[model samples]
Target: MYQLAPNIDLLFTEAGDAPDRVRAAAAAGFNAVEMWGPTGKDIPALKEALEETGVQLTAQLAEPRMQFMIPPKDHAPFYTGLDAGVEVAQQLGCSRIVVGSGTGFGGRKRQDQLDELIEIFTRGVAHIEGSGITLVLEPVNIRVDHPGALLDRTSEAVYVAKGVNSPNFGILYDLYHSTVEGEDVAAELANAGDLVKYVQVADAPGRGEPGSGSIDWPARFADLRNSGYTGPIGLEYYPTIDSAKSVRRIQELVAGR
Candidate 1:
C-alpha cells in the first residue's frame, strides 16, 4: 500500500504553528508529513515534535525559495542553498528535497538551458553524494500555478534525471501539476519509471481535497504502483472543509488500494 504524507505547510492551519501542525498531523493518524522550506521553521522545536509524535518528515524544498537551475551564473547560490537545505534535512531526518527548474531564460536556446540543468545537477549529485539524501526535481505547471517555469513536463524532468545519472537525483512526480499540464499521468509515470523518487497530489480544477475534484484517484494509484514508486505520496492540497475531514476519503482510498 502507498504511504500518505500530509503537507503540513498547506494543511492543519488551525493548529497555530509548525510544531503544533506536526502534532496535529500525528493526531490525525499520519505517520509522515512534508513542508515547503525549513528556513523560517524552528528546526529544534520541529525535531522535538517529530520525535514526540513519532512522525517522519518525508520531503521539503531544497531551498527556501525557488533557485534558477538553468543559467550557469545562478549555480553558486543554488549550491549554497542546497547545502543549507541538506543541513536542515539532517536535523529533520528528511531524505528527499524538492527542487524546481526556475523560469526559462529569455533568448537562450532550449537545448542550451537543458544542458545547463544537466551540468548543474551533475555537480549537485556529487556534492551530496554520500549524504543519504536525494534531490527531487519537481516540474511545476505553467498554466495555473507557475507561469514560465522551466521543466514543466515530466518527460523533461526524466530527461534531466537521466542526464544526472546518479541514484541521488530523481524527479518529484506531482499529479496535480501533471493534470494541469493536461498530461496523462499513467503514461508519464510509466515513462519516468524509477527516476521518480517522490510523489505529491491535489485534485485539479480547484486544487482542493481529493473528493472535491474529478481526478480518478484509484486509477492514478494503480499507475503509481505499476511504476514501482514505493515512496510517500504527499497530500498537498487546500482543504475545502475541516483539514482532518478533507483527508479521510483519501486516506481510505489509499489504504484500500
Candidate 2:
C-alpha cells in the first residue's frame, strides 16, 4: 500500500503560503506534506501552521552547500548546516532528511570521493543521534537531474550508509533518479534493502507523474512493497498538470494497483 505525500515546492507558483499549502494538501486528501526550503522561511511559524493543521511533514531536502561525496575537505560549515537542519527536522516531527552528495568533478579519484562522503555522513549522523531523525543520503541522477552529482549510484549510496554504520543514517531510494542513473531498480532494491529507509518516485522523460513516463512504476512499486518498503512513497516530482489533480491521478493509479 503506497501512501501519497505531496512535495509543496512542486506547486511552487500557485501555492502562496507554505501553511496554506499544508492545508491545501490536507484538503486534497494528503495526510503528509514535504517541503524543500523550510529553512529559508520562518521556521517557527511554519511549525505552528503544521501543528494547527495536523499535517505531518515526512521528509525535507537537506541544504546542498558542500560536496558531500566529492572530495576537497573543509566541511566544517557543511556539518554546521546539517546540525541546523536536524534541529528543524526534530521540531517538525520529520523522521528523514534528504541530503545531496555534492558534485562529481573531472579527475577526482572515485575512491577518495566515496571516502569523503562516508566521513562527512559519519560526523553528521553522530550529531543527530538519538534526535529520532535519520539522515538520508540521496543519489541524484547525474545524467539528467543533476548532471554532475557525486553520488550517482545506489550501490555507492548503500556503501556510504553502511560505512557510517549508524541507525541514524540511511538512503532514500528515488526511482526516477535511479532510472536516469542507469540502475536496475529491482537489483538495487535487493542489494540495498536493509539500508533504504524511504522511497520516492517520478519518471524519466518528463520528471512528472509516474504513469506519464516510460518507467514501469506499478511493477517497481510491487517490487518495492515485496522488498519490505512500507514507508511513504514520496511524490517528489513537478506536476505536468494541476499539482492537486496530478496527485489524485497518481492516487487512483496506486489504488488500482
Best by TM-score: 1
List the global CA lDDT of all models.
0.89, 0.80
Candidate 1 to native Cα RMSD, angstroms: 1.5
Candidate 1 residue-wise lDDT, 219-253, digit = tens? 88888888888989899999899999998999888
- Name every residue pair that clashes in candidate 1: none
Q: Write the per-residue lDDT of candidate 2 for residues 66-141, one digit (tens) a residue.
A: 7644345577777777778878888888888888788876677888888878887898888777778888888888
List runs of model 1 lying over 4 Å from the truth: 64-72
| Model 1 per-residue lDDT at 148 | 89
- Range of the 10 consecutive residues with the lowest summed lDDT in candidate 2: 64-73
Among all windows of ten consecutive residues in candidate 1, which has the lowest summed lDDT?
A: 64-73
For model 1, what is the error of residue 54's alpha carbon versus the real structure, in angstroms, after optimal superposition?
Answer: 0.9
TM-score of each candidate structure, all chains considered together: 0.96, 0.93
Error (Å) of candidate 2 at residue 131 is: 1.5
